[model samples]
Target: MGNDGHIAHLTGPRRPRALSPLREHLRDTFWFAPTAGLLGAVLLWWAASAVDLEIVALLQRERAYGAVRELMSIAEDAKTIVTTISAAMMTFIGVVFSISLVAVQMAGGQLTPRVVRIFVRSRITKITLTVFLATFLFSLLVLTSYESESSAREVTSVPVVQSLMTLALVGLSLVLFIAYVSSTLRLMQVGPVVDRIARETLRMLARQAPGSEDGGDGAGVRAPETGWMAHEGRAGVVRDVHVARLVRVARRQGVVLRLIPRIGDFVMPGTPVLAVHGGTPPRRALLRYTVSVGVERTFHQDLGLGLRQLSDIALRALSPAVNDPTTAVQCLDRVVQILAAVVHRPLGTVHHRDRRGAVRLTQRVPGWADLVDLGLTEVRAASVHSPQVTRRLLAGIDDLLLLAPEERREPLVRHRELLLQAVEQAVPEAADRRFASHPDRQGIG
Candidate 1:
């Protein structure tokens, strides 16, 4: 069916559990690991210094003079060296942070706002921040033990071990800073970002379609005719569902638990988020915990989000103020590939059950047709004026129609007609209309 909402709740086969909010947040947040790791690093260095201080003291007490004698001057200057390095690193961190924020802002404006999440979740960005902050902490800790003196040194043994380690960390951070700069610069480019979005979409397609060539159609007991509609307790996007747990609870209660909101769907307080059929409605607490809601949609299980992201990029490029047709064309290429993958793959559907095959969970997933509408309809409308965008749109639709089954033809034809209508509106001349309607990868005659 063309309508996603038309798919009624029904039971299906069981699936896996989803990550806890705390765990998912830790994974999504850019600073969590780095911040935690920096603290750990500080503790580790402090412990090392504690142990090494005694070793160095013993050597000094014995009037040791071999290798130690050679670096006595270096040790003497350790305080000044560590302090300078710490100050420079902190300053560098401020500058880099400011620049990165600018890049994020530019990307948010130029590309899709969702893409900003990509840059924020970047491993390199997180690592760079961690290194710089850690280096600052390291140098500061080393400075605490910096022994200064006129007659006798205020510090003992210059904390030589700590000095060397701090220097090493500083050097490593420098290398990472250079790499981070290169990565952030690359992120600013339109081509790489479009490709990345497309790649992630394709990856999700593969993940959602894994296991068999069979349709992802789930079969289970019909949802009870009468059921209580469960409303959302909080406002947020339905990020993911712990399906296994849902199926288990539904089976235990001998009822069909129809989750109302699909992953990626935005829900607010009082929105119908679930449908409880039979068996005393599973505790609202259980249902709420089973469904993971968040402020923003994530790429974790929402394949449509990735397509929406690419579509947004294309739309932004085609905007009157932007008017970058070439970028739109580039985005369309990825859209074409994503649609083709969808046609050839299995889409996640509601049909989860336990080992006994008794259907306990009936979930509503955006059907394949719905995804096509999401990925193409908006971009098609936006890019109509650009011949390149129009032609690519036709070609993408042609490819999808070719791969889709006979049952899906009606929806595909409707989409094709919609594209033609958009083409007519965009191109005044018959010759231009004829050229735009023709499906071609290059987008124009």
Candidate 2:
């Protein structure tokens, strides 16, 4: 539906769709496994106890096992033990979680709010949560088997084994508690967080590795004059695009599709999100599923969003309240390293094609100039009086100029001019301005 409540028509043939296994797994990393894994673990342990205990009961019936009777009595005692411990574990989990939350809050306040997602989406935190929940559920289920009435029907032979297993799990939880403390402390620090973000970004770039992937960098490319436009009906960030699936859909429909938004871009409802050229458009029926929209941007696909996270840290460090130029310089160091890898690589800009050499997708990537600006735009503005930040910012620009191709160097040069202008206005002393404007990683000033 259009914004004012008018009918919209889409032209295309309906076709069946399938997902590749890799993309399916990629979707799971966002929010599914953390919660699902916990529930699944509980079900697993319940099933485990049921199957193992039944087999032990069969062995006892075959052999006249007096030891089995003694074991059952111990298991009855173990039931009370597990139940009491489980409740305590619940309280323990609560305290650990509160401490972790406090650490996360500090990271957000000091680093950047956007990076708060990193802590929220952390694998260690997720796994710890799952284990704690699973342990509690396991204990509750085990205790139920020892109910006064159910004890009569319950197998006597397996009590000792079950008790031992629960005891071992308790021990494991203790170990996890120790590790969780260590992990939380690491998260609260600035060095580890920034380094982690940079490494992930570098890893993502290494996978793409220049000419190995099709990133819209085709020459002499222009959108076809005539085509249908598809408007997205929902508002959210473009979390992931099924590029392979989109290519397949375009191949089936025999059309050239142009995507309007890249990963991490926010899409407003009733906005033109894609274009179809030279054939029938696949329309919302096919397009909606191929594009995954969500409330938060993720690092799963958007390399630029990683840059945004890093830049946010730098900008925050430069804030008046923080006034920590050393931290800003550390962030700038990473920003330059990331840019050197990206600006020289193949940026998907113009076209992507199917196996038959037909144009299946088209896109526009952030140009070198725009990308440089993204890295420095805010920090530069805030560095008006901070000579340390200005020097590091300008030095990073120079490093990028040397690393980037000559054509891409234009933006770095322009940024240099602007940084000098800033230095001139803020630092009245010519010596200070000259030192800050110099292209050394550390300013003599």
Candidate 3:
């Protein structure tokens, strides 16, 4: 239906389409209101600038505003002013392009606001660059150098040079952005960690419920053989998690849940939540199975949603108790695999030695290892194994691998050899791992 009480009767009474919340809110605000007020403001400014009207001259200007009017002359200069505004728009676009370059450089958690991944996927840099180029051309061709007097005062060359510099920087930024975006995409494509985890989870549930076509996608399922740890409370972070209870609905459908142990405690791979008593739960129930286990509260809501439905169906067939240690280890291995897949430079490449004889790596963020109960791998990976740079150091401080930005070249290359020695013990494999695609990979970053 149209906005102004226009009713269309076709196929059953049609409901009016409502504006989205964001659009409706914007419509009510001054920022998005109609342009009548803005046009009025522009006309008033023109009147004041044209006649040089003082507080008491409005009546006189109105009486004599027609012949040889200053307003007419000012109106003639509108083209120039609009052109200058276009140039400013160009500069804003240039900044966006520059930011795009920075974004790609830090695609893998190197930049702020982890949500930038969507921006990268949107190809915003290309659109921004196009806008910038169009604005630059318009400003250069139609805005500047419109003067008629040949004897006019000489204009400073600064603005011209600044425009050229802006174009050059934007060009360079585009090159860098393309390179980093490609690299990041390659990394994500190569790492199969997330898919592997999802598949394993489905398989585990399928085994417990035999003769059930509840695999959802009919993908072959297998229970986790290793790397699974059972814990008593929730498994992952609860802050961002979405949970719902399906016990009542599931029970009505003949779902049987055999509480394996303490009912209130969280269950891991080794512990079972319950044995299915009746009909299979829907696969959607798997979504709510996200037990808080990791140190970080990053409970994956999407992962939960996808798995829960399949879990529900599996539970009805042959609900079995969860008991597997391999699941947790598999998760850990997935982390290592993902890191290895994305890293182009050896771990040694990014390390540096400071004046205080300390090794530094800027991006030393540890993975989600605290998912297990024993916390054995988490402790080893995060604490001891991480800090130990070498079996031997100058004074027991192995070389360091600082994961700082590439822009900070001075601090990194200043003491390369010293830093290498410090990190040698910590990452012996890094030395052999070649950053480049060669026969024998070189050591750490």
Candidate 4:
């Protein structure tokens, strides 16, 4: 039993639809944005060319020789600018992104390889790449429309609108370039990367529909004794589950469906995926569609991914190779931030019921104990030698103890005791043990 009042918002009538596999795949890709930009650039060039032709016709009909000469001169300058942009934009893109990728690679190595996913899914990265490509393509297209002869009397059309649009695109690319550079630099830092992961985790938690308390524990529903659905697709991690669809199918078939593996669990082919209680199991294909499998886990539905990532960073920081305790402390700060949010919420098994109050779908979620262990266990073990990490671990547990309910304090207390024991055994000097024993929010001073 968890805090019902604090979790009431999570028990809602509407359940979010599972993100499709294709949609999820596209979201992590860098090419989609640039491809879209190229198409948009083509359309823009067509429209600008049409407008320029209309303006040229209007000026000629008015017999404005002076204005036409001025327009021709502007077009001449426009050609030079467009030519420069078209020739140099791609090279600029290559140089900037090549450096960015190298920096991202180093950061990933310093922290965790999972950090690269943050760079891929970054909106600023995609948008900047898109604008750069669009600018280059627009300039190239505009160049093709420039007139060979530039005499006011003989000038059939002047690309005034096209030139203006190219200039605007170039300006936009420069602005985005600045933002992109700043964003890439932040990715190299530990604090910002950890914060982003934690924020994303909290957002996923907010999106989760925990269902009603009655549905929290399948109180009346009997265990599924009929059959099981095995995984038939290619082996990968379970990324998302179509809970709404599963509920509907179960309700229609008069059965209760329990998901076998959690969202982040990696399953091989022929692995049991669902347990059927009463009625005949749904089509295997239908069950397969409801679960999304990918090569790696993502934040799409994995609630524990953020904590796991933070733990990875902490472990990497404490590793003998890197040996940076300050970075480990930064990781603990964000880990505490994420765990604090989960402390008060309803967790563990969730039940989705139909209108008749019958349980239709039941899925296992990480409980408070599981999450506490996931976040702290490895870090505590690896931090025995690092007094900074040991103190921060104690402080994090103490902070969690204050916010956690009576029932939830057990995990926090257990972790705190285990951390102290590890520190005592690992630290040879009594003074070091005493320093590690004292809880310091900053890990030392």
Clash pairs, model 4 backbone: none
**Candidate 1 per-residue C-alpha lDDT over 229-318 given as tens digits, one digit per residue, 9 for 90 to 100:** 555567888887766667777777777776676788888877876666665776766665777788888776687887788888888899
The digit string of per-residue lDDT tens for model 3 on 311-398 reads 2222221122422222322333333333223222222111111222222111111111111111122212222122221111111111
Best by lDDT: 4
The number of residue pairs in model 1 that clash at the backbone is 10
lDDT of 2 by residue, 1-445 (tens): 0011111121243212323435444444645654685677567667667765775677666763555565566777787788788788789888888877788888898998877777765667767776777777777766665634333344443545555667877887777777877877887777778878888777655433122233443232344535555545578987766667677777788776777787678888776667777666675577657676778876655677767887888778878888888887878888888898787665646455676656576656555666678888887888878878887887888778778887678778887888788889878899987877766586434
Model 3 ranges off by over 4 Å? 1-68, 107-115, 118-382, 387-445
Q: Write the per-residue lDDT of candidate 4 for residues 1-445, one digit (tens) a residue.
A: 1111122234445544445556766888889988998999999999999988888888888988789888888998888888989999999999998998899889989999998999999999999999998999899888888888766767778998999999999889889989988999988998899989998898777667563233333433586458888888799999887766777778778788888788899999999888888878887756658787889898877889999999999999999999999999999998999899988877777776665556777777788888999999999899999888888889889999999989889989998988888888888899989998888899988
Each prediction's TM-score versus the true structure: 0.84, 0.85, 0.23, 0.89
Each candidate: RMSD: 5.5, 7.5, 22.8, 4.0
> TM-score for model 1?
0.84
Best TM-score among the predictions, by candidate number: 4
> Runs in model 1 with CA error above 4 Å?
1-22, 57-72, 148-158, 209-219, 223-233, 251-255, 355-358
